[model samples]
Target: MIRRNVLLLGLGAVLATTFPALALDRALTPEETQLIQQIGAHNSAIRTMAGRFLQVDSQGGRTEGTFFLERPNKVRFRYNPPSREEIISVGRGFYVINRKDQTQYAYPQDRIPLRNFLGDKIDLLTANIVDVTSSDAYMAVTISDDTPIGVVQVGLIFDKQTLDLAQWTLTEPSGAELTFSLYDIQKDVQIPKSYFYIDPTYKAVQPK
Candidate 1:
């Protein structure tokens, strides 16, 4: 769950609108809407990537890790050892595992927010593109959709210059804000499929 929780957060100071019941409480002009669609197209260009990430919580706690991502619903976030938490998406399931405890949690990929970006191809135009805002350094795209957890909103940030995903933030219905920032990113890298395989020995924790 740490992976899921961390995936919902953001970094440093930003010019942000107040969180609302609906992610898009305001309106997007014709130009702004088209720009967001264009950004979505740019995102889908990434076929594979590997990078390091810093997951910062609202409390200022930070965990660092290396991530391997292959398109079409496969990613592996291996946190530095002491953290003992890893998140992997294989096929249609999201698996969060604790190395030290040998405990694992699994959920249908659709149950989690932002799976659109995790797919083999990123497609924001097809989803509920609730809001799109940008700053000098980052373009923040807020995607809102109804999941089993009710309505969920995810803010995916891309570097304005490169149009690469920089970070993502989300405020859980419970008011937990989580953010993840990526660095040392390399694109079109080879990632082994074994990286996503769940250990059969790990104990599965059923969702409540």
Candidate 2:
């Protein structure tokens, strides 16, 4: 059920995306801001990333998928069997397809929250950040913003030493959290452009 949210957010930490109605607005500390800059630079350096993902919804339901990502707003998720869902962004908008029902959902690219992760220069300093906490192992950034649907909150965890995104938890408007864990990430691999193509015939379902 929350698989949809994962696509909206799980695009990976070449990967992650969020909203929260009770927004947190404040000036980031100098040190906090600098760290974000470093993380953003690290993320942007990764031009392409492909990996396997494990997503667990608030209800603890699990779904598996393969994540493909290219910089500046192109990503795809090929869900495993029994899931029958494929989510892709073609530098324009996000397309969610249901193989079993032959249904497709579309959302404007700009309307998707936490899009900083998709840009050529992942800029967290400009994000509506709520808080940031870091440890020797990783740095966690919590961001919230408004979207076409509702408020969403996204927590991104980056491995401190390597600066690679380890995982992320996305909290939807309903306060349901979906956690996506990415592994076996291959960076800058040759992924053909056809991987992001969406057929013209699929019907579009408007976001709720």
Candidate 3:
């Protein structure tokens, strides 16, 4: 369950969307390079974002949730009913709260795969991009980063026309995959600071 939660919030992003692997050392075309910059610019322009998300695990378990994000560090995911789970990052670290059992597991924000996506300025070129692909509808970039568990691959997809982030996928070292897609996303909206707040007094168990 702990590992699942780690991937849920740590490795979250889209279903089985696959693209042929591109050599990591290959040079990026000028168009692809420009697209990556545009995506980064689009991301940097957003101060806050709120949306509904659909999370699907490798086993096909589906979960719906509402998410809130504030630039540079904070984000929250409140899963729907039957899921007494919430993942919150209050800048410094991430806490996976299991409301049913009143248990909370904490991990350093920098230690999770989501750290790259939640940065103040998202520069795809600065990331360890392993793959890049584009079509009329979508542009995707896959980034590889190391975490405590192991190296994890994060695939980010954007709408080609708008360059807005559409979905993402995270592949764990153990071969488990988790996907997340956002909808009804409102950018640069006012999200209460309290939404990112995590209770300091709550006892948190650190993942081993």
Candidate 4:
């Protein structure tokens, strides 16, 4: 299951680096700033999201998958293409099911690196700005947490004109990165609550 998260992280890291920034001279106008604030605010309040994921690693490996995310802390990753596995988080607990082995692993969410990565109270823009720059096409902001073991840095790229989030990256402490690009991002989309529940039959494995 950690492999699954690592794969997703790799994808997000690559996508986050691909989107180049716009020209530096083009400062963000008041209107553009307002738009960015609104977008950030809206995203902060988003309760759930479903999207396609494409993750690439520094080693030239790639994985594609689908993800379901519920804010304030619930997420599920269904990886396809190279392998089959499911990772689901229910509140403070998480579960990983290995389809090939017909096994499951359970652990407290706080014990995993992903818990800090998927924090609900965080807003990519307002949370903290590590650095900000712009190019002819977009503006980029790098953000990171101050933790030791849980440290992760994210780069947010936004369209220069539209100020919409074009892409973002999640970089793990081990130097692994995952990039996530948003397409047709729908805010406040109704996601069924049942998606977060773990099946009762699967035996839970104690974390090592």
Candidate 5:
């Protein structure tokens, strides 16, 4: 099994009251509201996408990978050499597979923060949006939700001018954070269904 510290995908959690949904620290500005809506609509328009990603955890460990996404709940992340890990979600389930050991970990799609953004439609305005912040370069919307483990937060950051998703961050209840960024994205492209397939014979394991 993959080590928890290595992937830090301890995403299953229940809301622990540390991050309240819709209980914003402050109100959103008129412009901020408009931009948030536009961002939501822009992402909702993407039916399929392929891209390269860079993932960095709080400890500074970095991993580069290629990812494919099909709307309404399907995605595959294949890490580059030396890392035999792939995270695939086909409809209702998320699977983390270790190629080296043929070991797998499973999770329900709804229990993950990715569910909020991967659906056929994205509505930040109606989601458990806890905070919205912006800078000259990017606009960020932070969303919180309950999981079996504890409260988990995911932040989506979009390019300020283009309204395109640039990166996202996930924070575990234990305060470990992982930042994932996208590049060379090709939107509306066709990807094979086999890419999201889970090996039926892979050994199943629980999250560490």
Candidate 6:
């Protein structure tokens, strides 16, 4: 499962790298708007997702992991292969346990990027869409947001056939990128309430 997550993440990074040129002059066509609307509609009601993710850093290092996500705020990531680690987020805070170090780190939800993964209010179409383009294979939407950390670019890739989200990329202000791919997606799945609670045994640490 961890391998699956890493793979998904890698896929996302690949797609993000494929974004159209920043200086392109094409505007969002009617067809593109319709497709975007369709994609948004299909995902609007989705409340939970569980899958494997593979993440590759800019340096080409790779890690595989399994992840669980519940909308409006909750997620868990378990990395595997050589090292085992678990990071989970309740609605208001996040906790990470490093098995090797026997250390735990906890922080407010807003302090981490995980906050963005747990909400539906984030609308890509209405955001700062910098560019839009389409090909026979997929529709690409590029957007950016200004945050205290800096401007972050988000690229959304949608399958041309299904109009579903194939992947997304987040380009940090520092030029680092994190991507996510969705596969074996289960929508509206029932997740237990307890899944959002932090374990009491884990020590809590304040965010810097």
TM values, all candidates = 0.85, 0.87, 0.89, 0.64, 0.87, 0.70
Compared to the true structure, candidate 2 yields what TM-score? 0.87
Model 2 lowest lDDT segment of ten: 11-20
Weakest 10 consecutive residues of candidate 3 by summed lDDT: 11-20
Q: Highest TM-score among the candidates is held by which one?
A: 3
In model 5, which regions exceed 4 Å deviation? Answer: 1-22
Each candidate: RMSD = 2.9, 3.7, 2.7, 5.8, 4.2, 5.0
Model 2 stretches astray by more than 4 angstroms:
9-27
Using TM-score as the measure, name the better of candidate 5 and candidate 6: 5
List clash counts for every candidate, in order: 7, 9, 6, 19, 6, 10
Off by over 4 Å in 1: 1-14, 21-27, 147-150
lDDT, each prediction: 0.70, 0.76, 0.76, 0.59, 0.76, 0.60
Selected candidate, larger lDDT, 2 vs 6: 2
Clashing pairs in 5: 13-147, 13-148, 13-149, 13-150, 14-147, 14-150
lDDT of 1 by residue, 49-78 (tens): 899988776777788899988777778889
Runs with alpha carbons beyond 4 Å of true place in candidate 4:
5-36, 102-122, 125-128, 146-150, 160-164, 184-188, 205-208
Q: Measured by TM-score, how close is model 6 to the native structure? A: 0.70
- Report the C-alpha lDDT of model 4 over 51-162, residue by residue, as the tens digit: 7766555565666677787787788877874575687787766677766766677656654444533667645444444446557877666555433335556666777666
What C-alpha lDDT, on a 0 to 100 scale, does residue 163 get in candidate 5?
A: 85
Global local distance difference test of model 3: 0.76
